[model samples]
Every structure is written in structure tokens, then in C-alpha cells.
Target: MPEIKSVPLSRAAAPRPGSASRPSAASLRYAAPALLGYVAVRITGVAILLIAASATGKDGMHRLAGRWDSVWYQRIAEHGYGYEVRLPDGTFHSDLAFFPLLPALERGLSALIPPLGVAGAGLLVSWLASLAAAGGIFAVGARLYGRRAGVLLAVLWGAYPTAFVQSMAYTETLFTALAAWALYAVLTDRWITAGVLCVGAGLTRPVAAALIAAIGVTALWRLFTAWRAGEPLRTQLQMVVGACLAPLGWLSYIAFVAVREGHPFAYFDVQADWNNRIDGGAALAAFVVEQFGRNVFAGLGLCAAFAFLFWVLWLCVRQRPRQPLPVITYCVVVVVISLIGSGYFGSRPRLMMPAFPLLLPAAVALAGARRRTLPAVAVGVAALASGVYGAFTLLGSGPP
Candidate 1:
């Protein structure tokens, strides 16, 4: 496979003697441009949002840290779970639907500073996590392609349509940060570190199931290859241990919910109340069909959007040097989960933010642009478009 030639698993698993164990000052310098570009894109997006909010007489800060799901996270931070609201239709909206890590962090930060409050703490966590996520993305791209591709990858991610969520009091940035670093750890052959970060990702969002699946699959593949080649048992054991640890955080939370609710599948039941269920895309198909029945243009638009997503996935798969198994597996799993689940349609893009690998092809193309200024111009245009879209959606009645 191209991946074997490009990034051999065995070689990554064992570092050379005298090499730095973790990112060093030089590594930070290397990724500074990508981090700076990402921050610039995000700042531009926020500035646009603020201007739009001012024009509409809406509070942008409140929208970012106090509205919709942010409210639920802050509520969890301020008071432990067991909060629920019943809609007129008799469905229960329970706090148990949210994972605990973000709230736990908000609670800790608020207590530490006292003046920051839960909302402020949540925003701070998201902002910092976004930068970390950008750096990790740069590292991964730089490892796979080159510094230029890596830089473009980070900038493009910041210019994503739902990139505004990265600046909000949301789990997307936190989960992306953990997921990116975990993938980087896997790329560099640090299985234990990957497992630990996977645990954190699992704690932050249900989407971490994708991350866990990626790690488990990669580890199993490595073990199979090693056994056939008669590789060292120590390496195999490390892979086994990491694979075993990957799902503990997600499973533990489910077990907690089950015990608390006095039902073996209480977690699923909680999610069902929120209309979040894995239905093999049945609900999505129904939604599209209903859209067609109501408005042909809206239905066509939805179909085009899905087609675009799959096209990007195809581009990712067709890259010159194949992506590592974990990267490909993780991206595919994230996309599958986003499409197959039944829930609020508008939130699907935000939920897929951690599927950063989807941007690899675009980043590579930008990096290889004939004109030196072409990449910058393209990224600038994308950032502007993203900013305007973010402002519009954020100011609208619906959740982004």
C-alpha cells in the first residue's frame, strides 16, 4: 500500500535515539504560520459576527456563550445533571444527553478564576482548544505532505463553513483538539498517548466514537501485520493495550447513564428523546423527500450539498500518497455518523468539523498553486465567505 511506503507503522512506533519525545521550540516555530493564519481567519469571522449582531440589535457574545446548546453545557457546569425540560409534545430534553468533559472543564475553570463564570470559562476553553487543534492539524499535514500543505490545511479548516463553532462555547473545538492530537500521536507511533487523548475526546462528545473506532482498527491492523512478519511482542502488546483503552471513556459514560436511569440502554433512551438516533440514514432520506414535496429548490440544494461532501471524500481517497489508515478510517467514520444519524439537520456541518482530513486534498492543491499569491488569495476569499455565512446563520432564528 502507498501508506506503507509513505509512513511505515513500524518505523513510526519506535523513535530514533536522541530525538525529542514531544514537540519542541523548533516544532512550534515550524507551525507558527499555520496557527497565525487560523487565528486570523477566526478573528475575522468573529468580527463579522459582531458587526452583523450590532446591525440586528442582537448580542453576539451571548449568542456564542449563552444560547442553545451552550446554555445546556453551562447549566451542567453550574449544577450537576438531572435537569430536564418537557416539550408541549411530551418529549423530554434531558441534560444527560450531553457528555461531561466540557462542563467539567467549565466548572473547574470558573471555580479557579471565580470571576470568569461558567460561560466565560467555556468560551476560553473553546478559543484555546481551537489554537491547539490548528497546531495539531498542521503537525499531521506536515508529517504527511509538507509544511506548506500543513499550513494550508490548518488555514482551510479555520475557513470551514461551520468554523464559527470553533469560537463558540461548543465541544467541536475541544473534541477536534483532542482528536487531532490523538491522530498525530498515532502518526508518530505514540500509541499510549493516542489512547489517552482518545479517552479525553470520548469524554467530550459522542462523536469520539469515531476516534475510538479509528484507533481500534489501526491497532488491530498493526497487530495483524506484526504477527505475520514476526515483529516484536512488546510492540504488539502496546497496540493491544492502547486499543483496549480507547473505548473506556465512552463506554464508562454510557454505563454511568445506564446505572443512573436504572435501564441498561438509558443512554440511547436519552438520545431518543432528543431525536438523535442511528437510523441508517432513513430519517435523512425522509427529510430530503419531505423537502422535495415542499420545495424542489431546497431539496435539490440538500442533494447538492451531500454530493459535494462525498466528492470531497473521494478526493481525499484519491490523494497521491494514501492517508494513514487511522486518518482515513476516522474521517470516513465521522462522515458516516453525521449522515446516518437522525437529528437537527442544520447541526450536521458543525458535527463534522473534526473530520479535518476532508480538507487535505484542497490544502494540497492550494500548496501546489502555480502563483505564490494564488493560495493566499483563495484562502482569503474562502475566509470571507465563511465569515459572511457564519454571521448570517448566527444571527438567524435557527441554530447553526
Candidate 2:
């Protein structure tokens, strides 16, 4: 592998003179290879899933758009949210725990086209969002590293172990698309654009807190630097405006829930009912220790996996032409949120799907490979493994 070179921070953070932050026709053309590669990987995964589903006499489409959280989203779309379930354990699971953006999209889209039901509309939204996410990921990578790295970064995201979720009727793809573009906007100094995208992300998922924090932190840092440099307030006004706008969507939803439930912390209460409230990793530690009692190898493997996650994160932290402050902040918050939550252990990877920045190290390495065919071979193997795992997990008794 060739060593990856880093650009100076000033060069990395500042857009080239006269270059627009928004993608141009030329930028789209440059990103076409990445988009196509992402599509191909996703298509291959779906193909494998369909073949496996057929062999087992199962409906792949239904599995993709009608299972687990997908059902919750569709229910919200078709009948709006007052749904709840009383579990045998005397706990309640309320639909309000879910964010409303995906459901809203499903309802609107299905209403526009009668032939596509709510579920079908959800699948459509997810599929399209996945493509947009690929484009945004490519743009970020290309800006920081180069076109080749950008292409690999997008493709690698599509070939993630839990990339299967990107195809299902879930908010992961939609949130990721918004988050990726939002980070890109921050990188390019398009403060208001970043904040707008952050608003969309906030409306889509509670994890939008990470994106909100990233934007807030980045804006504060910019304000401080600008002030120290004696830059005028007019130039820093957009940063302040963007930071203010970034949290509104999330705050609005929380306020809505508070009013609806007649409690100040109704949103947190709802999450607690679903057992997803953050516990500072206490639950995660206990779960891992319990796994050791059940099966030592499984416990060891889990520990190793977590170690690997942190190692990759460290790589991101130390990445050459270092990642912008917003990117690092976003990725770190996403990981922390994913691990500290007391939700079902099986869902952690899916929760972390929006943390696409963690894959930067691997993308960089692949881009620096000496053998031209090495990256393609690695991607092929990864896609194959991911597809197999996805089929098994999706078809098994548990939710993925």
C-alpha cells in the first residue's frame, strides 16, 4: 500500500477560489463512477437476498419493506401515530418513539401515486436516499482526498456489513443522505446549507443530535477563530444563524411531544418506554459481561469488534489532511450515542449506519493500494460477505 498524503488543513478546509459549494454538472460527472459502483453493489446484495429468499420460499420484497421497524413506519404513514403495544412485561411500546419524516414521505408519496402503497413508497424513498447518500459521500471524499478515494468511500459504505438496511424501508438511508450532505456543506463553509440539511436529519431521527452538536461545535470554533483574527461580525453572522437553525427541527419535535404528552420530557419518556434511553454504556458493559458467561468466544469476538471500531475511529482522528472538525465531531457523537443507548444489542450497527466517516480509513487505504485490481477484489469480497450475512440475518428469527 502506498502512503496516503495529507493536504494542509487550510487547503483542506477552504474551498478552492471561485469553486461553488454546491455540486456542479462537472462534479456530478466526476461522481458518476462512484454512484454507479454504489448502485451495482446494492443491486448485487438485493439479488443475493432475493435468491436466498426464493430458495427458502419467502417474499423478499415483503421482508425488505414490511418487517420490523418498516411496519412501524408504514403504520404511522397509513394511520398516523397513536399506536401502542403493551408487552407481556408490563411495558408499553409507543409509536411516538419513531421520528415522523419517513412516514410523512411515505404518506405523501403513496397519496400521489395510488398504485404504490405506503410500504412501496417507503422502499422507494429508502432506495433513492441511498443513492443520494452515495453521491454526498463521494463529494466529501473527493473534496478531502481525491476522486478515487471518493469512489471507494461511497462503494465501501454500500458494502458495509449492515448496508442491507440501506435498502429497507427505514430512516437510516434518509438520515445518512442528509447527514453526509450536511457535513459536506460544513466542510465547504456553506453554513446555512449545512444547517438546513441538519434540520432534515433531525426530523428524520433522534440521532440527529450528533449532527446538531457537530454543527454547533463547528460554528463556535469558527466564531472564536474569526474573533481572534479580528474578522468582522458580518462575516461570522451566517455561522451563528446556521448554528441556531441546526437545532430547531429536533427541538420542535421534542416540544411537540412534550405538549402532546403534557410533560416537559415526554420525548425522553417515550424513549425510556422503548428501553432506548442512554445509560452511559452501563447496559452495554453488562451485556458484554453476560455474553462471557454464556459463551466466552462470543464475548471475545464482541470485544474484538468493539476494539476494531475504536481503532478505525482513531485512524479517522489521525487521518492525514485531517477531517474537518464537524466530521470528527459528528462521527464521535454517533459512535458514543450508538454504544451508550440501552436499546437492543442487535440494533447497534443499524443505529451507527449514519456514521459513514468511520469508513474513511479503509477507503483511504484502498485508494492507496499499489495493485489496481486490489480495491475491486476487496470490494467484491466485502460485498459477497455482506450479502450473505444480510440474507441470513434478514431471514432469521431476529430483527436486523
Highest-scoring model, TM-score: 2
Candidate 1 lDDT over 1-400, as tens digits, reads: 1122344545543343444554431288889999999999999999999999999899998888888899999999999999999999999999999999999999999999999999999999999999999999998887776678899999999999989888899999999989999998887777888899999998999999999999998888888887889988686776677778889889989999999999999999999999999999899899999999999999999999999999999877665244778888899999999989998788788888899999998887888877889889999999999999888888886364
Q: Which clashing pairs does model 1 show?
A: none
Clashing residue pairs for model 2:
none
- Per-residue error for 59 in candidate 1, Å, reads 1.1
Estimated TM-score for each candidate: 0.94, 0.96
lDDT of 2: 0.88
The C-alpha stretches of model 2 lying farther than 4 A from their native spots are 1-11, 16-26, 398-400
CA lDDT of each prediction against the hidden true structure: 0.87, 0.88
